[model samples]
Target chain A: MTKIYELMPDIQGEEMLILQNLCRDYSEEKLRNFATIYRTRRKDPLLILVLTLVGLAGFAGIHRILLNQIGMGILYFFTGGLCLIGTIVDAVNYQQLTLQFNRRLAMEVHQLLNREV
Target chain B: MWCLLNTFFACVLRTFSKKTFLSLPCKDFKSDDGMKSGIVRFFVHNFEAWFWLTSLILLAFMPPESTQTTFCVWHLLGFESCLGCGLGHSISSAFHGHWITSFKFHPLGLVAIAILTIRIVSVFNQNYTFERLNKKFTHDKNL
Candidate 1:
């Protein structure tokens, strides 16, 4: 009886809780499928943090683009991450941003798996 | 400077990792203080949405023509100009109905506002639908 977190060690506690809640009724096979698809879709918080730090070096907004926020990515790209204030803020809140994106991803995966069955 | 940046990043990562491990999972919902925890969880889950909303409101209220001190870090660090320097002022002017002045302050201010508005809406929409799904699941489980 392996736990959901065990399957995805990169996921934070809050995200694990969300995933567990979503997959409460899933069979083992379905859960594995969900995890496999989700692993490919989810963004790594550490990667986002590094990208945001790159924003400080005059290449800002790559992280936003990675997160599928193209408009914000462009703004950050042109404005130097709102003069680096936005980049600094994004650095501090990288976990939250990643969590939000991952939560959406988990929901999408859940729906997709359920539709398949 | 590189050493300083590395140290800062390391500190941030350490703090975040510590917080992540300490955070409780779904078991918190079954506790005696369900209502309090639910409210706290809502705030924790939707923090980014609230942040953008608060910032937009504050910007909307700020006087467009005030002689405010600059808060740009690049300026403080002795840089002559940064691409984002006049963005806030531009947004403030736009909010106050001065489209020409907003463009004069910064051409991209209006575009930024539109983009931020869209981002805020989409974030809130995602949370709304997800919460509804959670509630439906819980209801079905109880039955």
Candidate 2:
């Protein structure tokens, strides 16, 4: 039986705990399915951070669009990330943003696996 | 002041570095007792929403023609023009019922307000759903 850590080694700490809690009662096959799907869907915080840094140069808001925030992306695009203050803040809070997105994705995956069962 | 800035930058660098990016500090979730920390956690969790809201309010209150000082880093860096240069004044003018002036200052001022307003609402909605899902799982564990 592969543990959650073995299945998703990149996820750690609170994210790991949350995933474990989510998959508490799942069988090995279902857990594997969930992990596979969730891994592909999850956004990497480091990638987001890099995109945000790029935003400082001229192309602000690509990160927001990548995170499924179209309105914000547009706003950032037009306003230069609210004069780059918003971009700076986003750069600082990249971890929280990624965690929020990944947690939502984890729940969606859990529901998906449940439906398949 | 330098020490504080250095520590802040160091912390930011550490957060972005490959090695420590995955294991985020559990400060937001670890403390459940202190009232102050809980408020801090709430702000941290919904930072984007709060930021837009605060910016809008500040813009609303700012005088339309005041040119005493600017907080724009681009201007500080000696750039003569920036994409967001007049946005703040435009929004402020719009808030003060001068739509024509707002348009003159920045064509997208009104649109920016609308977009930011929508973003704030959507962010709060997302936060609500995330909290509800978290509660649902924690409840199941107690059962």
Q: What DockQ does each candidate score versus the true complex, computed on alpha carbons?
A: 0.46, 0.45
Once fitted onto the true fold, the runs of candidate 2 whose alpha carbons sit more than 4 angstroms away are: B1-36
> Candidate 1 chain A — worst ten consecutive residues by lDDT sum?
A1-10
| Candidate lDDT values, in order | 0.76, 0.76
Alpha carbon lDDT at B7, candidate 2: 33
Question: What is candidate 2's lDDT per residue for B1-143, written digit by digit as tens?
Answer: 22123335534544444332332223234443455554545555666677678678867887888865566778889988776758888988999999999999999899988988887897789877776777787677668
- What candidate 1 gets wrong by more than 4 Å, as runs, is B1-28
User: What is candidate 2's CAPRI-style docking category based on DockQ?
Assistant: acceptable
Per-residue lDDT value at A22 in model 2: 80
Compose the digit string of candidate 1's lDDT tens values, residues B31-115: 4565565555555555556555666676788787764556667877998766776777788889999999999988999999999
lDDT tens digits, residue span A14-117, model 2: 67877877887778988889889999999999999999999898789999999988878888888888777778878877877888788889988888777876
**Which numbered prediction scores highest in lDDT against the true structure?**
2
Error of 1 at B23 (Å): 8.6
Provide the DockQ value for model 2. Answer: 0.45
